[model samples]
Target: MTREFTTPPASAEPLAAPPSRTNRGLLICGALAGPVFVVTVAAQALTRDGFDLRRHPISLLTLGTLGWIQMSAFIVAGLLTAAYAIGLRRVLHPGPAGSWTPPLMGVFGLGLIVGGAFRPDPALGFPPGTPKGNADPMSWHGIVHAVAPPLAFAALVLACLVIVRRAVMLRQLGWATYSAATGVVALVLVAWPGQDGLSMRLAVAVTLAFAWTTMLAFRLLPPAG
Candidate 1:
């Protein structure tokens, strides 16, 4: 006698539907946030008067006639980044990186929003007419602005560390190394001494962080298989 086994019904098997459009859109939004922020700030830096990229920080752009523009950019970037954090949560698996990255990114985004809302005081002779010095007496807003960046930077650094560990676990040695290096560079640049090239270093650090974030978002996309 011959025996045969019946195949399971299609419905009984796990459905393999394509990734939802909403998730795709959210991933794209997260990817675009960095470029949008960098380009907007670069444009403002080039056109705005008394805005010395070497001696002054981009946060100073949130002052004077065109202040609203940078302020809006900051808020927009932050919102996009926060949304991306949500997307990250949906896409990443329930592992070490997945557990840590989303929340850290959310904190980074929040720091951006808070920093933008509490605009930094005039310093390094920005806005064309301000005194050639730091924000004397340091208002509450200035203090908040000062604190926000370090907090955001710290979060991003931690996120990168998580990514590094995740990459190592996945056997992506190159990515692991890159993530570790990026974190180190960010930490060093943000802590650089003196005012010279501070803006450039900070810009580089922010760019590196966002570039890594965008790449990670792309990596987390569901495989086409």
Candidate 2:
């Protein structure tokens, strides 16, 4: 009897090992991070006694009697995102865009945790008790709080670009365009610090960025085999 050899079909990406339950759980956390954060911010922005998304940035929610709520939200979201990054490596590895994306995402997640740990100084008359025009002589923690978001945003933008490259390589023009748009728009929003609409702009940027992350996580989720 004669035996014949067969080969698998050609593809852009190599098939990854099947994901275990732990990895699936991590991806689920990644998917939930966006909703958990966006909802917390929206609900607090709408319900807080003096909070106003039009004027007060979401960071101010980390102040006052209800401060812990926002703080917890940030930390939780950060943890979820970090876990997702770990899971992302499993599926994205041995492929394009795998080198920098996961580390960048981890950096972004760390920034969130730092921002939560070091709350910004109350400003713009938020929490109904602070004077306007920023806190005087800014606290060290406040400075760290100020620095975290931009750094985090920068990392996210870089990660977006990396993914865009991957998408283009795979001939996924639509996904590439979407990733490019999200990255560029987010960068612009982060750079602009206008007094009139800073809060609104940041809110939109945050929602958009996290939405993209959630979408990416779902798209990369391994199939049942």
Task: Report RMSD (Å) for each prediction in the order shown.
Answer: 6.1, 3.2
Q: Residue 18's C-alpha lDDT in candidate 1?
A: 37
Distance from true location, Cα of 79 in model 2, Å: 0.4
TM-score of each model, paired residue for residue: 0.88, 0.91
Report the backbone clash tally of model 1: 0
Q: How does model 2 fare in lDDT?
A: 0.86
The CA lDDT at 63 in model 2 is: 96
Q: Tell me the tens digit of each residue's lDDT in model 2 across 1-225.
A: 999995543322333435678767878888999999999999998899988898889999999999999999999999998998887787777678877888899988998898789999989898797897789999999999999988998999999999999988888788889999999998898687556788899999999999999988877765545
Candidate 1 ranges with C-alpha deviation above 4 Å: 1-18, 223-225
In the range 96-193, model 1's lDDT, one tens digit per residue, is: 57778889999988888887798988877787878888877999999998999799889989999998887777677887898899899999998979
lDDT of 1: 0.80
Worst 10 residues of 1 by lDDT: 9-18
Winning candidate number (TM-score): 2
Clashing pairs in 2: none
